[model samples]
Target: MSDMRGEVILRVVPRPADINSNGHIFGGWVLSQMDIAGGIVAGRIAKGAVATVAIESMKFISPILLGDLVSVYAHAERRGRTSVAIRIDVVATRGGGAETVDLTSGVFTFVALDENHRPRLLPDA
Candidate 1:
């Protein structure tokens, strides 16, 4: 995915413990990273608290290996009365030459919430 798709929201290096028995980063770990990135973008658009309602789509394009530098990018793809769909793409930079690879991509929906924890209307963009 291009940087035009979204801003880089999160970046971190996976520790050894983050790897699965297969010697690749766990899918759940990557999913959590995407969720976090989606929530950040969604909350900013909503201008308040937001809760993840669903993962509309997800695709693991490539494996994230140990020592890979992972970066998660996200942008709001769509917005409803109280929910926003965030498209998140993850890229991994590995090896000494700084080769980049697309690792995963997903679309997640989050609902804006009021202090009462009920869904609230999203603020105007």
Candidate 2:
């Protein structure tokens, strides 16, 4: 799926190590990658460090096998006083085809943190 209304924050192709025995990408790997992507956007929004507080609505819709290039995109869906709600999407593509399939999707929440690790208010979204 394409985010015509938003911006792309992260794009990556999955490697063999990213696949699980079930022939799909490992859930942890996907989550971690998404977390990294969220941090990228969150840091820019916070103008400093940010910590992941919660991840919700995580749902796997399809499978991703070895050699399947998975592209993950993230964007800020909404903003709160000290937090930002981010929507992340995973897309997979095979060499035989030119199209990409939506594998999974979810929203992540993070809190802006100061240099001393205390929670700080984020800038406007």
User: What are the TM-scores, per candidate, against the unseen true structure?
Assistant: 0.95, 0.88
Model 2 per-residue lDDT tens digits across residues 34-116: 89988888788888899999997899888776777767788888889888988888777877567677788889998999889
- List the RMSD of every prediction in angstroms: 1.3, 1.9
User: Which stretches of candidate 1 lie above 4 Å from their native place?
Assistant: none
Clashing pairs in 1: none
Worst 10 residues of 1 by lDDT: 1-10
Would you give me the overall lDDT of model 2?
0.81
lDDT of 1 at 13: 90
Off by over 4 Å in 2: none
Best by lDDT: 1
Model 2 CA lDDT for position 90: 79
* Residues 9-100 of candidate 1: C-alpha lDDT, one tens digit per residue: 99999898898989999999999999999999999999999999999899999999998889999998989999999999999998964699
